[model samples]
Target: MKGRIVGVVLAAGASRRFGARDKLAARISGRAMVQAPARALSGLGLSRRAAITRTPRQPHALRGTGTALWSVGHRRPQAASLRRAVRGARATGASHLLIVLGDMPGIGRAELRALLRHGGLHPAMATDGRSLAPPALIPRRIFGPLLRLRGDRGAGALLRRRPDLRRVPLGAGALRDVDRPEDLRPPRTG
Candidate 1:
């Protein structure tokens, strides 16, 4: 039988570095940072698309995004949000999950498509020459360890433990994520 691919966007961070505002909602090039990746996922034609966050309510920031609600409890850690997304993906009979961070402004549909093309049954992540990070594709067989996670720590733990995780190299631009105001700057064109 063929497998179903589910798109899961992780957007529940406190954005402590962004001062008073949620970085995910922050605009880069006049569009919310979260929307960049959300739009990419929507373009993938996945069986289901879910965005997970711990905010009390879906941010007005996400209005009209078209991604479904997959929120975790308030005050919960990032792991909680991830667990919720994973469980929901499993419930929908998804065989693989494509996990992308919500604050990434450089995420494009082409880059997302590249990740899926290289990712096989095992976990596959995008690396920016320095470290492995999201825009990762993880198979159901690896979901067990993800459910055992706690706190705000994300897939780093799993990647560290599993040296076997495949990595697909991406340019620095595609790997850049928004954390502070400066990170929202448009990429240099010269």
Candidate 2:
């Protein structure tokens, strides 16, 4: 919280499980799923904010949000996009990298703010009282390990293994991500 924190939205994943359409482009509520995460990060007014995508064309939802769009090779692994974001953040003198998944429309400003508040000087990641995952706040010092991540691997595993990682508890459904079309449906109310 003392230094510049750059928010990075990882949106380059191929929607293999979401059928032919891009999952990030799909609407949740009235907004594109990807926009939810980007808007949240943008609202924080960090030193800088960027969204990584597989295409050079920017998403309509990101327009006017002041979040820069960075494109990586199509179908590249999650780590490739993440590494690209990390490098960009470092270039801008970011002291911490706040990572959010574009598919996780459920994550909002509240959860993100919590991560920053409890993040301290070490890495802090959101937990649903169970598994450790992103919407992670990672210090610049940890960027080296993130740059070494390979293939489809993400920071989740690495964060889980780190003794210095702080787990910030969020609501049960806060980390829910849309993987299939069915996941977009609102919860049934009995």
- For model 2, the stretches where C-alpha displacement exceeds 4 angstroms are none
lDDT of 2 by residue, 92-135 (tens): 99999999999998889999999999876789999889788789
For residues 1-190, write the lDDT of model 1, one tens digit per residue. 1369999888877778889977887878788889888888886768898788775477776778788887786677888888888899999999888998998878888888888887676778898888888888888998888999998778777875787788888888998888889878777888
Query: Model 1, clash count?
Result: 0
Off by over 4 Å in 1: 187-190
**Candidate-wise lDDT, in order:** 0.83, 0.88
Deviation in angstroms for 60 in model 2?
A: 2.1
Q: Model 2, residue 145: displacement in angstroms?
A: 0.9
Error of 1 at 33 (Å): 1.0
Lowest summed lDDT across 10 adjacent residues in model 2 is found at 58-67
Q: Estimate each model's TM-score.
A: 0.92, 0.95
Clashing pairs in 2: none
